[model samples]
Target: MASVTYILFVSSVVQAQEQANIEKLGVERVNPADVKAAEDIADQILTKMAEGSYYEFKEGEAIPEIVQLFTKDTQKQAYQQIKAQVGEYLSSLEFQEAYSLSQGGMEATIFRFKGDFSKSEPEVRVVLDRDDKLAGLRVLPWTDQL
Candidate 1:
């Protein structure tokens, strides 16, 4: 019984330490340049998406590969869904945070933003690949209440 209790206590402490280390690492891995580039891409994408003109950038205006990631149907569906839930876009996005990570020999940067819409504020995450092209974009319902 005593041995079990000691093991449980040590395990809990180790877990706590690991979590703290992860938080520290996240803070240390941020790159301001990467964050800025990712933010620029995210702003452009969000603006176009909200305006229902995503396809307009397909003809050599933006990164073709990144633009192709979301098909026309998917973009339309996502645009409609966001409009229905969040109403019209209110203002430019506010940057929240960013982090950098290595993935399969490539470096990736993820920037998070608070998007202000007419109805609700959503959290938008944009990931940029090593080539500074958008690799992933996700808009999640805001959980933080002001």
Candidate 2:
């Protein structure tokens, strides 16, 4: 029992540390064009979600890259949940910031955006891998602290 408890605690700490690292965003330098491109990708995605019937993915107005398979499925479910919570999707307000993080020798750029919907506003994050592929996407309620 004692060993199991210790292992669980250690695993939790490791997960916390990983999240902390992402929050820190050590890299200071970022390309302006890259940020713009990332923002565009994020915008395209949200726009599609807003327009697509039943929250399905739209065909046109997408970045020319592959979104992660898991992300696509997960995003569909998550988007549905968000739609239920926030009502219909409207328009995204603005792009916030983009930052890069490296893990296991691979680097990914994460971009933030402020989103607008019928019922609520949310903050969105889009992650693009080194090859400019969509790696991850998340939407959360807006918080002042970010």
Candidate 3:
């Protein structure tokens, strides 16, 4: 079982209430199987975006349908933004860590990869909800923290 964990977000988007809830996460451990399943979904989505496909992510595999918080256009925009900042997505790093987090009323697992791009290597974060839905996903400026 995963131990109780707390996350502190200093981002401008996070408000006091949300931060409070986020700090309360970490009561149970998520199954490794769940992590793998979620990662597979994240990989598929990221791969498409990285390849500049900009297609719908929930393609053919509709069994465990993923309801993402972001829309198709949003996904495209985010990835495009990342691509613009970093350049083409040459490949994902050879090895990276996946993070599991639960806070407030949200529980999710994330996979962060050092994306090798044409000009830079930025951090790509993918988050999936406990129900295996897409909770959040984004590409952020590179940070060595993870």
**Among all candidates shown, the one with the greatest lDDT:** 1
Off by over 4 Å in 3: 1-32, 57-69, 93-95
Better of 1 and 3 by lDDT: 1
Q: Which ten residues in a row have the lowest lDDT in candidate 2?
A: 1-10
1 or 3, greater by TM-score: 1
| lDDT tens digits, residue span 1-146, model 1 | 01110100112222233332212125557776777776776676667777777643435333454455566666667767677776666656877776554533545555777878777777766666557766566666754421
TM-score of each: 0.65, 0.63, 0.60
Worst 10 residues of 3 by lDDT: 1-10
How many backbone overlaps does candidate 1 show? 0
**lDDT per residue as tens, model 2, 32-128:** 6666766776666666656652223335322333322324555556557667766565765576766655655556666766768777667666666
lDDT by candidate, in order shown: 0.57, 0.54, 0.52
lDDT of 3 by residue, 41-69 (tens): 55676677676565464543322323333
Order the candidate numbers by lDDT, best to worst.
Answer: 1, 2, 3
lDDT-better candidate, 2 vs 3: 2
